[model samples]
Target: MAMDFSNAALPAHYGLHFTPTFHSKIPPNIDPTSTTLPNPFIVVVTGAGKGLGYHISLAYASAGCSGLAISSRTSSDLDALASEISKIAEKRGTKIEVLKVVADVQSDSDVSNLEKEVRQKWGRVDVMIANAGVISKYVEAPSSSGSNLPRGIVQDADWARVLDINLNGVWRVSKAFVPLLSESKDGPQALISSCSMAAHSTISELTPIAYNVSKVAGMRLMECVANDHGEEGVQAFALHPGAVVTPQTKNHAGGQWSDILADDEGLAGAFCVWLTKEKREWLSGRYVSCNWNVKELEAKKDEIVKGNLLKYRMVV
Candidate 1:
């Protein structure tokens, strides 16, 4: 998993674990906002064909969420995941409905279809997980590996596609689904997009310009949504899912960082669920790392707000 530099500022007794169990339950007294935040009733996870997104779907299912819709470009993976979730729901005695939609993040028509299907099926959305993203495939880039290219020479086509998918795709999900999210029951709805450790810092050895730039922009976009739409009952967050082993990480053209990457299958998935289920309004509009001890993070709320830590600012 990616290192938790945030830990450096915390007390050792907090027991911070970046790879902590993802499915950990939120204590009933987690925060004062717990009563206002209802259990995740309807959820939509993008890039859910395999890997982290699939695991996140399972987390919500096991929580007995009523509705789940997972989207991806691959049809077979979605089918298998739907079937697996069905079995899990049955075994867990959670009456969860699973909807699998084959949709590519880069395609406008595909996203529209996704929104349409979810609204038609469930009529409301509690959480929208924008987990679809990509790393650039620049073969001639130069980095620590000597094979990657420099920022100046990165191809235009590659940069455009990466930004379109990583950043623009997230906005697409919010725009298409925000209406449904606003209609959620209880106090507020949520938007949690999958970001990366690279969004905070890039590796000189294998810098992925497209992925890095797009992630930073997307993270900021989430904050903007939170700031501008607070009265509309909208809650947004940018999340770094830790360096989990996945197809994108294990074999990215930029070189694999999956070696020291987190090996836990459910960390990212479980953390996302916790963020939505618990009352952590203080962390809204912030970049949240799955590796950080959220309880410790809660304890640091005073310092975090006083210092304006997670938000983007020039320190003016």
Candidate 2:
């Protein structure tokens, strides 16, 4: 288990020290529905059939993005999401071309096919949201279970599967779509992946060991992407979409953490739009939480960059 660090003890820039008034909901400054994106902008979101993915796609459509390509493993879910996007376009007296694709991130062929389809339709991608991820069954501590059964990462049958989908999946999407982002005629090309605080937390009771390790490795991958691709005009970010409960989370350990999952589903979606809406290169390649107030985050820009904060590093 990791150390039991307290959020209140962390710095203001970490965003865990927010007042009661400014928790996890979407703030007015970065609300997508009230914002307008540039013309001819195109975005691709994976695992977008439901949950935070659905809301993120909706935010782009609400912001008047020119085109959107959303993918998921379920065809029915894509159909439902597409219908909602159409409704939003009509209501706002705007037009948004929605392309739906069915894909499993674990499959190389499926991910390639998704990239091919998007390239054929839009010829370029402005933003890529690699949001497909999965968690393994809980691995109880040896002390908790009476039997001497295996425990933690070594014991979980689905350990490899979680890393494959959560960590390697991010790599697959990045490998396929980053080139298209570079082809964009606009500014601020970005690749944002759904990450979690579990990357830094060691609370075994809250999540499985595989989930925690995959998140840590995933953030490191984001950092590597930023270092390698910043010269190519592609900015990458690891995003901790606020603690919102969806089908994925509700079933975890029979809803054990449901009480703490109070963030609005719209928070992360709006934050994505706000992140890539303009070129804030200073914040690229860092870990950001949707629950953080953007205004306060902006205020710490100089300190963040100067101190090289938010990226993982050894304390010693």
Candidate 3:
């Protein structure tokens, strides 16, 4: 669990947060109905060995994305994913020029080389998904089965490692790919930051402090990319993929709550594909929840734009 706005002590800026007074939902002015996104998108998904990244790559493949590049630390995982995508392409009737790269997101040279591979092969990277991240190590197991759970105190190494892979890794990926994204001329281009709801709220007892803090900073990074490059026609978004079980969860031998409400990984992937579609400049530099009905958000577009909702700020 993440933060609770009503109870937890927050930053000074959050104290001035206020809900805007609005009469009704207004239609968004942008007419996306006519704008067509490029099929077979030129995509680069880091951390594509498994979990969310793998699903996202499959989503792109099924969507007829032609130029696809996936990176991972494990060559075997990448090999398997490449084979799967090939089968998908064979059946789906689209040519997928895919490349599986072995690169560590933590290394600058490794990330740079990954970007170079994509650019050298396809010329431009239309969508860059920064999905490489890590979770905290288990500090202690709960003693009782049905009693209240005590928060585990994180060690310094645990904190540092999580931040290194989850936060700095994302920065490395974006830095390597943004230039290629800016160079694209075909259709909409985006830098997708794989964020967590932990950024908004967390139960200190249940969540990793490092993971939560990194996501908060990650969201801010998306805003910086948007503000710095909006005029250059680059779109960026920090997305909260709903609670879904990952390999880490499986390894942790998850509790009863793991069986509770959770979204399929595919849902996040589909949302990402849709986000890269045309006329979505209004959403740049913002944080989005994948569970929100896209059409509903569209209907209130005017209100969202005018009110400047869905952002962290200092004043009303």
Clash counts for all predictions: 8, 0, 10
TM-score of 1: 0.82
For every candidate structure, what is the RMSD over all alpha carbons to the true structure, in angstroms? 5.5, 3.4, 6.1
lDDT of 1 by residue, 217-285 (tens): 987998998887766788899887766677766654333443445446676766776788744667778
For each candidate, what is the lDDT?
A: 0.72, 0.82, 0.73
- Superior by lDDT: candidate 1 or candidate 2: 2
Task: Give the poorly placed runs of model 1, Cα more than 4 Å off.
Answer: 1-40, 138-152, 155-157, 202-205, 252-258
Q: Candidates ranked by TM-score, best first?
A: 2, 3, 1
lDDT of candidate 3 over 32-108, digit per residue (tens):
22223376468899989999899888878777777789999999999999999999889866688889899999899
Q: How well does candidate 3 match the true structure, expressed as C-alpha RMSD? A: 6.1
Highest-scoring model, TM-score: 2
Model 1 C-alpha lDDT versus the unseen true structure? 0.72
Worst 10 residues of 3 by lDDT: 22-31
User: Which 10 successive residues of model 2 have the least lDDT summed?
Assistant: 142-151
Which scores better on TM-score, 2 or 3? 2
If scored against the real structure, what TM-score would every candidate get?
0.82, 0.90, 0.84
Better of 2 and 3 by lDDT: 2
Rate residue 314 of model 1 by lDDT.
Answer: 50
